[model samples]
Target: MEAIYIDKHYNLVVECKQGSRKACYELYRLYSKAMLNVAFRIVGNIGEAEDVLQEAFLDAFNKLKDFRQETTFGLWLKQIVVNRSINLLRKRRLELIELEGDHLENIPEEESEDEDDVQYQVAVVKEGIKELPDGYRVVLSLYLLEGYDHEEISQILNISENTSRTQFLRAKRKLMEILKRKGPAS
Candidate 1:
């Protein structure tokens, strides 16, 4: 069933690449909502996410000729949206810095702050994620939210795998600090 859906989009992608506006709109209709969610997760602003989505779609349309079939069309479109979101953040002078040695305490991945204990709302966690630094938020969103592994995040962010891991662990710690200050559900 999923394969058939992808095949249908594959046809749309071919027509879109051929400069068919109707096909382009059809593809956008199929993808825009989910792509907006992806952008919003990274930028943490609905307006910026909308702008990113527009810019990404335009960029994708322009670059359609260059897109080889190494990956699925949907994945290619997703990469465009993600890259555009990161670029917009970069344009705002948000640099994703890698911490030097000894800066971060080594916290094991399983040492989570016991999320179930608080009975906190999802909104609280989302707010905490927004409060994180640009670097941490990007890494955390890509990893925890987007389901990318550290290696994939490293490739996406152009950082070392170790750096991605360290940043993610630190991001978790910072999120925990924010949540703790917010206190448990009453």
Candidate 2:
């Protein structure tokens, strides 16, 4: 049996496709902030993320007629935002290195904190993510935040699946270190 996906914004999409400027603006307003967060998480820079968001919206608007609506408009726009963010990173010569067994061992793991001492704040975690290296941040954001699996991440980054796993593991370890240093409530 095929699953049916319902889009709450179907009318808006149809109107936008028919060249309704109000519909286009409404679509952008509904999606831009969430999409901006997605771009910012991947690109690690607000300015770059804003650029990606703008470009993705433009691309989506221009191609609205071609959208088949197999999925929600939000998901389609997210794909464009993520791709644009990655392309911007590529423009900066972002390199994702393949990890061999020996290289993986060289990455230090953070010591586990005491369960009683563990505390988390949204801002603290956000800052920790921002401190991560670009490659690690991208992989972690795609997997943990964006809900992509290792295989999808591998295809997106043009790296091996094993490399994606390694990057995610290292990113987790590094984020732990940053959170630990921030203190119980910080």
State each model's C-alpha RMSD to the native: 4.4, 3.8
Best by lDDT: 2
Residue 3 local lDDT, model 1: 36
lDDT of 2 by residue, 69-118 (tens): 87888998999999999889889888988886724444463454655434
Query: Can you write out model 1's per-residue Cα lDDT over 1-186, one digit (the tens) per residue?
Result: 223334547888889888899999998999999999999989888999999999999998998998766678788889899999888888888766676563666545323355774345677888999999888899999998888898998888788888888888889889988988998666
Pull out the clashing pairs in model 2: none
Give the poorly placed runs of model 1, Cα more than 4 Å off.
1-6, 103-120
Q: Among all windows of ten consecutive residues in candidate 2, which has the lowest summed lDDT?
A: 102-111
For residue 172, model 2's alpha carbon misses the true position, in angstroms, by 0.7
The TM-scores of all predictions, comma-separated, are 0.81, 0.87
Off by over 4 Å in 2: 1-4, 102-120
